[model samples]
Target: VVYYFQARGHGDYDSDFSDEESGEKSVQKTKSVKEDDLLRKPFQKAKQGSVVHRRFAAEEWDREEARKRRFHLISMDAYQRHKKFVNDYILYYGGKMEDFRRSGENDKTDLDVIRENHRFLWNEDDEADMNWYKRLAKKYYDKLFKEYCIADLSRYKENKFGFRWRHEKEVISGKGQFSCGNKHCDEKEGLKSWEVNFGYVEHGEKKNALVKLRVCPECSYKLNFHHR
Candidate 1:
């Protein structure tokens, strides 16, 4: 006689199966088997009073594939937004370059023309301007790499604009500032590193940002924009 196995999450048992059409059956329970080992075995017994819940492993794999597809879709949306910011920033720099090129032409050599062009490019913003993207990128990029083993955002070739677009968003939105972090100095250019160094040094002692980001008492002395 063919035997049917009952499925239970935590219970274990044993049994046999014959061709379903013939309806012939096996007479013996071959051996005691644990739940994990018995999965592929044919003609198994279910735990007493348990029901068989059949599952095809392919359904699980399909669910995982769907999740991956959704993730890529979200990433593509972010990429498009980043691309738009890059185009806008490029236009802004191009205008500045045009002005500089015209002004330098009379007294400038071929070398000066090239240098001025490069200067404009260097002075341009590093990020696309979209609110909250900078904050998200700041936390997301490192987390994604460490936990998921994903490549850096730099590897997203389709988003050639780079994560710097997030910095531009922060600056434009006023949620943060882009100026040098030093309080005494008026320099508008420097990495965000300087801001934390001058303003958040005491806060940095803690490895966690919550502790490191405590408000700087000295920052109140400077203009709010300078704190950015």
Candidate 2:
């Protein structure tokens, strides 16, 4: 009716059966025990003090600070040009530039007031002029970025900041944002584009892994094997 066969090791067994009418013989495969389970060994999380984690974390922080500083400087430069244009337009239209300034507030508010009153000073020909200025400003910004911010990669080789160089290159080359490598995942709605390295740690040492890929935040979570 039924037969049982013992496997070679402990907690291992198999079953054999026969149909009475057709006389067909069948064997049911037993689930094999993994070596890890047998040895009671489990994967351990990386410790906070681990060299790999600490090194990467510090690099990431530095890269972020650098990026912020770069953006702040560029924005200030752009704002200055914008302010000069606004002042010239207001003076040409017989209006005092100082009249638009908000008392005790920052230069940003002044820029905002000028923008709100743009229609009063800007005409069709001035639109073309503004476009020219914008183009010139963008070229200047790009030149500065490539010369200063991206001249060195040694500062961010091991962290997410290294991706900035690649991103900047792509932007300069007109490539825009690269698609996330995952085909089935469509989770890039509001997440910033990131170049992520996929790798593993073994015996307290991080193994250098494959090429970095462009990925959205959701796909990154899966690639990193994050549990949460």
Task: State the displacement of the C-alpha of residue 157, model 1, in Å, after optimal TM-score superposition.
Answer: 63
Candidate 2 clashes: the total is: 0
Candidate 1 has its poorest 10 consecutive residues by lDDT at 144-153
TM-score of predicted structure 2: 0.16
For lDDT, the strongest prediction is 2
Evaluated against the true structure, the overall lDDT of model 2 is: 0.45
For 38-145, candidate 1 gives per-residue lDDT tens digits of 675567654558543446557777899999977866777776866655667778765443433335446855444433322111111424442343434334433321
| CA lDDT, every model vs. true structure | 0.35, 0.45
lDDT of 1 at 4: 82
